[model samples]
Target: MTYLDKFPTATLLVIALTLGLAPFVPEPHIWEKIKMLLAGTLARPVDIFDLLFHGFPWILLALKLTRQATRPN
Candidate 1:
């Protein structure tokens, strides 16, 4: 098992808080893109990239936690 498998909850929390919640002075680029998405704006190349970049960690962490929960102890 990798380090992520060993510490899925901690890993998820850190990623979620850092990438999803923490505010920046100018605000995060991903946050702006996410707002655009919510407002029904067309996605630009950079917006797509920003979404994927910020979203990948959450996707990975959720998958890890789901796998861990369903696995037999």
Candidate 2:
């Protein structure tokens, strides 16, 4: 197993905490940028970077989980 498979729990926890709870904090910048993106208003370079910074980990975790689920036992 590679590093990703070895740390599935950690990845899941990060996904849950970041995407689930982080947005509730005062002035959640990443969440705001995501909303702007969905509303077709995200254009600033820093906002784009913030989106990628917070989003890439979730995407990778999702991909890892999907791969693990699809793998034959």
Candidate 3:
């Protein structure tokens, strides 16, 4: 929405780097969740929630890019 339009790109990037790819030890949280998703092991409720939680910032960043590309307003 217009709210996201007003959201700063740098802030989104920071969020994407931080929460989107958190727990950068063994592997990024999002990366692990994605692997679980592809391996059909993401059926647990908490795993599902983890995916959504970590993916939210990236999702918003993607949505922002898509909106900017399609709607110049």
Candidate 4:
């Protein structure tokens, strides 16, 4: 079967976006308290690599979906 027949594109996009975004969701904000306890030590860099890694796929998928949605089937 072809790609469209194999999966609903919107469902795939939601799943992909959810999985891609899973890492960056702050952990219930409880970690803020922990950080305070530790005096904000062990600071993690704003992982630019991770940002790009997670970001590009979603942007591409969005663009693809937009193009497909707007175009006549």
TM-score of each: 0.63, 0.70, 0.93, 0.45
**Local accuracy of candidate 2 as per-residue lDDT tens digits, 21-43:** 45666756567877899999999
* Runs in model 3 lying further than 4 Å from the true structure: none
Give a tens-digit lDDT track for model 4, residues 1-73. 2454455677768855675565545642233434443675434444444444555556656766776777677
Off by over 4 Å in 2: 15-24
State the local distance difference test value for candidate 2: 0.74
Score residue 19 of candidate 4 by CA lDDT.
Answer: 51
Could you give the candidate ranking by lDDT, starting with the highest? 3, 2, 1, 4
**Residue-wise C-alpha lDDT for candidate 1, range 1-73, written one tens digit per residue:** 4766777588687887687544554877567767889998836887687778777777777878788888899
Q: After superposition, how far is residue 51 of candidate 3 from its true place, in Å?
A: 0.2
Worst 10 residues of 1 by lDDT: 20-29
In terms of TM-score, which candidate is stronger, 3 or 4?
3
Cα shift from native, residue 53, model 1 (Å): 0.5
**lDDT score for residue 57 of model 1:** 70
Give me the candidate number with maximum lDDT. 3
What Cα-based lDDT does every candidate model obtain?
0.73, 0.74, 0.95, 0.55
Q: Is 2 or 3 the stronger prediction by TM-score? A: 3
Candidate 3 lDDT tens digits, 1-73: 9899999888998999999999999899999999999999999999999999999999999998888899956
TM-score quality measure for candidate 1: 0.63
Residue pairs in steric clash, candidate 1? none
